[model samples]
Target: MNRTPEPMSRRPELPFHWTLVLLLALSVVLAACGASGAPSNAPAAEADQERPIKIALMAPLTGGAAAVGEPQLNFVRLAVEQFNAEHGTNIELVEGDTELDPAKATTLAQRLLADEAIYAVIGPAGSQEVAAVAPLLAAADLALVSPSATKPDLTEQGLPNVFRVVPRDDVQSATVAQFLLQRLAATRVWLIDDQSSYGVGLVDAIEAQLRAAGVAVVRESVGQDETDFSALVTRMRADQPDAVFLGTQVASQGALLARQMQEQRVQALLLGGDGLMTEDFIANAGGATEGAYVSFFAPDVTNLPSAQPVIEAYTSRHGAVGPFGPPAYTAAMVVLEAILRASAEGPLTRAAVRDAIAQTNQAESLLGIPIAFDTKGDIQNASFFLYQVQGGAFVPAR
Candidate 1:
């Protein structure tokens, strides 16, 4: 019966060779698994997914516009602090001072990109600066969220990686023109700009909109450094436009124009963009800023319920927040959200973050506005706020 337990295998040699092959295969797998080197794409993945992800803020930390740029950077810092506290994540900020200069902005952007570590950029607060560095950012596929660059052409350039929190110059210009016609019944409007891209673009945009709305438009241009505006004011006095729209910076030239208008007895109500929403403008214009009108990209954040803490905290630390601060905070918020989202999915590369940013739809923005981006990277559902200078202070007009 136990004749010969049919040899355990028909071929004993075959069984031994098969056992050896299996053992060798297992040993190879174990050796591979035990190796200390990283898996595929580990270097890039580790660098991108490192703790304390880095972000850079590009603003004028020095120069004439430093006052505006420094506040913006602090607001960004506040946003990052709040984000880190609430989310249990660590994020570090690197400063790149653009100084409100286009050339400087390009250089700084290039330097940031060359480093291969900075994740996102907060500013380069001026329109010219944004315009200059936009191409570099687009090429590098980095996400650049600007708080206060309002040039009309910027968003139209089709750079998917660039996003601005505030409305564009074209939209603001049209809003200002419509307000002039309906609110002030401005039949004759005098348009003047500082010949810079921001000034020229805004004035032209307003003129087009005003003429289309059956309002009379007169145009003029001035250099950025032109301080003595007597000739321009004298012309204004003779022409007698119901309102004068000055597309210039507050400290640079807008205040001087307001002062000279008063001296020349030009009775037109001075209407300016957000640039004129500063104490320096009031101080420089002295009593001449009285009865003037100004429009801003965002409603005063001091009065917003969501921004109360930000305002209080910013004021406690930096004395006073500038017109650009709230927008910068919102920009930071959006950028942080994007970074977190990209991190959740996989590696936090610039392109991944940019993709996440383009999907933003902040239901309750820090500035009391719904923050969203259109295909062109312009803020959606944006509105302009009007302020009237009464008794030497800018007060909400609407």
Candidate 2:
């Protein structure tokens, strides 16, 4: 001890750097395990876990209406992607094809309703399909917003969960009537329908509007699935009306009718609804489709500054813009906004989101308009626009 106390042996200090590294590695592994949908993150495990909001999109992806429905779905998808990218929240999209059939739509609605995760549903492209599924959605307390279902009955029924972006067919028909009487100065008109709820409803409205405007209904005919339309053409030629109003979908039958009308030298101005405003109509009718007027829900994107980015992104990704592109985008935006607004106060539940949507007023959207809903969940001020086919393109009717 007196001899330099045998230099005290130094105890080894822990390599704190290595300890910190190990701790960090362990933390990372735990985080990864948690994110891997482990038991702790199971649906039932954590009641407060922020579940990704789910949206169900029902449309005709593989049927006659696919031409219209597919583009709508594509636009919705684009909007969802953009919304998620902009806001770091996950929004899951669940697609179900109804094939433009009411029965199929009902089936899809049942399936979507069973999925407790789905917060909202987008469509059942046809008006009839919407009518079929309205009760199902109401029973499930699910919110549904359609971009193309324009039947007045859906809103008139006072369904608290149902809404649409497009104006009703009745409004469209009245607009067309006004344009025909005031703008085109067409006195006598021939009306034709495909016997569908949409077609027949629009025809009735147009006829009523025309009569009110003091325009004579010269002749009326009903078309079926057949392609032959010589009979209709002959009848129109005999009536010699100033215009022909087609209350029908853009089917081969309708196209043949227009073509036959042209071939028979019937010079009546052809008019139709959004259902007939398609490139197929122009292609099938050829020169006959030129100068034809169509009444449709306006694509508000073209005029809205807020929608420009959405339109550009959509075109870049999908190649073709959706029909009612702005409205479709706005519909998705509405859903997202409702979710955000609801989540601000508490967890995101279907009922809370639906209530938020119903209570929403003057919410600015890509449509460049204040969004609000009436007591019946319908957009209070929805309106339609008139467009004419010129050089195979649909331009606003002057």
TM-score of each: 0.79, 0.77
Q: List residue ranges in candidate 1 displaced over 4 A.
A: 1-51, 114-117, 194-197, 220-240, 250-267
Tens-digit lDDT string for candidate 1 (1-398): 85866665774555532543454465466446435444555654454446347788899988998888888889999999999999998887777787798998898787677545567889879888988998998899998999988777888888888899998877788789888988889999999887877778888889998999898888998887777889878888888999999988645377788888888788888888877777777777777888888888877878777788878988998886667788989999999988999989987688999999999878998889888899999999797788888887888886
RMSD to truth, every model: 16.1, 12.3
Candidate achieving the largest TM-score: 1
- Give residue 181's error in model 1 in angstroms: 1.4
User: Taking the tens digit of each residue's C-alpha lDDT, what string does model 2 give over 261-290?
Assistant: 889999988888877776787778777788
Q: For model 2, what is the error of residue 388's alpha carbon versus the real structure, in angstroms, after optimal superposition?
A: 1.2
Query: Looking at candidate 2, what is the lDDT of residue 384?
Result: 74
Give the poorly placed runs of model 2, Cα more than 4 Å off. 1-46, 195-197, 225-240, 250-267, 298-306, 324-326, 362-370
lDDT of predicted model 2: 0.76
- State residue 123's C-alpha deviation in candidate 2, in Å: 2.0
Give, for candidate 2, the lowest lDDT window spanning 10 residues. 16-25
